[model samples]
Target: MKFKIRKSKILRNLFIAIGLLSLGNLISVYLIFNTAGVEAKVTRLLVKLLNVNLEANLPTYFSSLVLLADAILLALIAYGNRAIGGRFWHWIGLSLIFVFISLDEMIQIHEQLRAPMEALFNTSGLLYFAWFIPYMAIVVILGIAYFKFMMSLPKKILKLFILAGVVFVSGAVGMEMLGGLHAEVHGEDTLTYALMYSFEEFMEMSGGAIFFYALIVYIEMNFEKLRLRFKPKKKKKKIKKIKKNLIEA
Candidate 1:
């Protein structure tokens, strides 16, 4: 009914996973570029699955799953905070945001905005992707809206949250802008572009992992224990007897 998780162990595993995924992406890129003659079908499939720059692949799924994990953690924290009469809604909002982000990661909702945004703004260079504009606006709005809530957090949590945000945004927006510019100039088929995007994905994944760790730490600090309980089903005969006794009384 109760489960105890070692936070350090979890953090270590997360870092290991991130490192392996990044290495996989790098190897895939290298193999794709260096391999001459027809590649084996399985090798080609592995390359496609491991490439971090490509969509609908292992890296993308991992990222989405990471975001989903963050959302679940945030939701649990929100429930815990609500029970304690703390900042319940703020945690809920974060959970919701992560939920949307997880879905977006899988479906590439932001990517869908690129072409229309480019057409509407006639943007180029750093804005070649054109998706980060709206995303940046949303970030600004969220920053403003959550300013007070962020300020109210404990210094440790506040610092971790800021660090995670910077890391994630630097990759998701900052590197994206630079990558867009690079793609606009040299095009996407280059090794340089692959490396840039790979780095970007790495940052995003790392940020999510850090944020997940932070949430786990927060829960450990604020709650006595994290656990789950399942209730056993009542016997029908017992229920009927209890009902009859109640009626007689």
Candidate 2:
């Protein structure tokens, strides 16, 4: 027997999930900014990434810039995908795009979150994900646009999202295994650390992926507007021609 999901409940669950995730993330960010102890560490990382040696604070321009660019790129992507078929291959392609971005996000989160922990141990050469926060924000913003606006995704998008998760986790493990062997020989915690990093990244990205999938599904469920925008050549003229041929026949 085939499984069928209800549209209304899916829509409800999706929005609820997005709301909770966004709220939780905002609270965490508020804490990061408000607390002095975490604030300094976060500032130091930001300064280093921006390469600002002067005694000035970080600018809000970073966010505005990312948002501006993300808006453009997202609009382009949505417009570009207006008429894409909702098929297995198409699903795979979309999944890969999300996965590629998702993996990059995982790597970035690992770098960013690991910095503070590394700093706790006084690891001097450690680096932080200063600009990465903004970059990730763009990804999230685009994700929101993808969900809210662009409504064209494969059937069973949830399954495709899960497939991407499996692939990413497998790749992460494989890379770490090779490094882990080396770490064992060198008497280092590199493998363990890498695993910890991957896990952290996975946690952060996994929720975003689900939100992303739900967004795609939402858009797909409303594909008529999406279709009219996409299928320009198959409009009135084509219908007129078909009618003329039928009348003659």
Local lDDT at 118 for model 1: 93
**Per-residue lDDT of candidate 2, residues 1-249 (tens digit):** 112456467446644643453444334344434557755776555433332111121211222222233333334335435445423333334454554553443243444544564446433211222323344465566567556223454456555545544544443443334434445455343434434333433343333444444444544554434423445666978999999999999
Summed over model 2, clashes come to 3
RMSD of every candidate to native, in Å, equals 3.3, 18.2
In the range 1-249, model 1's lDDT, one tens digit per residue, is 123589889888988999999999998988888877327786688788898877899899999999999999898888787666777998999999999999999999998998999999999988899988889999999999999999998789889999899999999988998999999999998999989999999999989988988888788778765444344356766898899999999
lDDT of every model, 2 decimals: 0.88, 0.42
Which residue pairs does candidate 1 place in steric collision? none
lDDT of 1 at 219: 82
What TM-score does candidate 1 get on C-alpha atoms? 0.89
lDDT of 1: 0.88
lDDT of 2 at 71: 34
Model 1 weakest 10-residue run by lDDT: 224-233
